[model samples]
Structure formats: C-alpha cells, structure tokens
Target: MEAHLLPCKISSDGMHVDVQAGFVREETDSISFSGHSVQKANFRGRPIFGTKLPIPPPYEAVLAHPTDSLGDKEPARLFVKSKVSSITLWNLSDEPKASDKIPSAMLWLKLAPLIHSDVTYSN
Candidate 1:
C-alpha cells in the first residue's frame, strides 16, 4: 500500500539509507486523521476521525518480506517494527514533528508474500 512517510530511518547492512517511516492510513467509513483504531473505537464515539489504521493487507502480506529486502523476514519485520518503536534521543531530531499533518515523503511497501514455513530465521 502507498503511504506518506514521516521522517524516519531505514537501514539494510548499509546497502540502503535515509529511509523514512509512515503509518499506513486509509479513507474509511469509521475514522479520521490522527484517529483511534477502528476496532477499538465506535462511529458513535468518534464520528470525525482523522487517518484510520487499515487492516494489514493480508496475512501473507504481513508475514513476507518485501522483495527488496531479499525476502529476509526479520530485517523486513524489524524495519516495520521501527515505525512504532519509540525513537531514541539521537533520533528525535529526525522524526516528524507531532504538529505536522503531512509527512516528509511517500513510500510504497509491497504486500507480504510468504508464510511461516517460508521464514528461515525468527526472533
């Protein structure tokens, strides 16, 4: 899915650099920008939501690594986990300000294409 990326980082054994992260958002009947989770909130409770979290594309999409990540599961998953993971004091300067509505850039992430049996390593 396509997303506007907040200022963040991406690393791949030094093969890649200057990456940003953005939460996947979708226009939905349930929520709005900076919105609460759809499954957690009700229309009655928050009729004017901001960006609503999307259901992760598919089970396979959530599990498999992007082809660019060499289909390496942990690294790809870690890249994703970093989006929600808190930033360090060192990283805070690079992060998007909480007041910024639009992100610094956009990125496209492929849907996951693997299953548990396909993973060669695990945390």
Candidate 2:
C-alpha cells in the first residue's frame, strides 16, 4: 500500500488531515495509524472502542466521512497529543492535503446527535 504524509492544520483539540486510500477500500478493512504507538481504528463514524495512549498522535479522528458516493461510508476519529507536526496515513493511493481548521460546527452537531451516547466517545 502506498502511504503518504498529509499536510494538516492543528486545532485546539487535534489536527485535521485528509488521507486518500489508493488501493485498500474494502468494506471490511480498517486502517492503522502508526506513530510512537500504533492505533487501529475503523474508518466508520462509530465510536472509538479501546484504551487511550498517553503519548497520543498529533491529531484525533473526529469523523471519517467518505468523500465520494461509493456508498462506502466510514467516519473515524483520532486523538493527538498536541499540534500535528506531521501525519502519515497508510494505504493511500495519492497524497492528500492537510488543514488546521476543523470542520464546521454544524457537521459535528449533525453527527453528535446521530451517534448513540452509550457508545464510548473520547478525544
């Protein structure tokens, strides 16, 4: 799989990085974020289910909405320790751009209510 580090902007909470998975887009496969530690998370918007790393990545996955109409929707969220110095996403077909600004509050609002509160959510 071709991997690339995307240019991401940092928010108060975490960084925003866009990754383009060039080859691996199967409905059942999940991507792993590797840094000082490795974090495995599904690209779907489902709540995170695992332990939190003290030395976290520079960005947190808030949502992982699919960009295209492939009908393969997978929203994900991640947590970074501080500002994102860099970002490397695996299984990417092409290089992706980065942004420091977070997505619109409305988007979060739209998604927050949809997700079940019982589901564990952390950043």
Candidate 3:
C-alpha cells in the first residue's frame, strides 16, 4: 500500500512531536500524535485508570544519552533484563505536564493510484 503524510508540528518542549505516522484501511485515513514523558501513574484497582507522573522539564544542556560514557553502544543488546528497569524509571520519573493540545497542520494531497500497473499491461 502507498501512504502519504499530511502535516505535523513539534512542541516547544521538543518532548512531543505530532505527525501522520501512516495510513490504513478504506478511503478513511488515520493519524497519530506522540508525547514524551518521564513518569506515568496508575490507579490501583480493578479496571484501573491512571495518569502519567510528573517529570522535570527538558534540559537541552544536559540530558540522557542513548548511550553512556562507558561505551556500551549496544546497551539494548540486553533487552530482556533492561525492559523492567526502563519501565520502572518511566513510571516514577516526572513527565511533561499533559496539556497544550497543540493541533497539527494538515495538507490535503491526492492519493496515489493503488492498482498494479503491470497487470493492465499483461496479455
């Protein structure tokens, strides 16, 4: 399937970026916006609903590196052990204030032809 991007924007904090990631199904379209956060909260009960925890603002000067000084370039090479540790930090760390529902810009473009061109040429 061929997909087209509509339009998108970045948050002032840079923690969140919005975009039309991809499309699927019918003439109808799909879109998505993602936000970055340090913390998430959980309501402890049956059918629990929760809120994300609060995190410090993004600091451009100093921030977490995808890798560390020790040179573990492929730290994620240890996925099984790291997943839990990562989730724990995500749950407890402070996240961006969940506000500022900034709207993304949209671009209307004609969809590309989807049928197989070679099929029409075959004898």
Q: What is the TM-score of each predicted model, taking all chains together?
A: 0.18, 0.16, 0.14
Model 2 scores a C-alpha lDDT of: 0.31
Per-residue C-alpha lDDT of model 2 across residues 21-117, encoded as one tens digit per residue:
6222332232222112322333343222111122233324332333345344744434433343333342223211112122233235446655856
Cα deviation in Å at residue 34, candidate 2?
A: 7.8
Order candidates by lDDT, high to low: 2, 1, 3
Residue pair clashes in candidate 1: 32-49, 32-50, 32-51, 33-49, 33-50, 33-51, 61-112
In model 2, what is the error at residue 63, expressed in angstroms?
A: 19
Separately for all candidates shown, the number of backbone clashes (residues 3 or more apart, or on different chains) is 7, 17, 6
Residue range 1-123, candidate 1, lDDT tens digits: 323222235445847443333222233454322243222212223322233233333322222233344454644333342222211111122222224433111112122344323657778
Off by over 4 Å in 3: 1-45, 59-123
Q: After superposing candidate 2, which stretches have Cα over 4 Å from the reference? A: 1-35, 45-84, 92-123
Note the Cα lDDT for every prediction shown: 0.29, 0.31, 0.23
Model 3 scores worst on lDDT over the 10 consecutive residues at 102-111
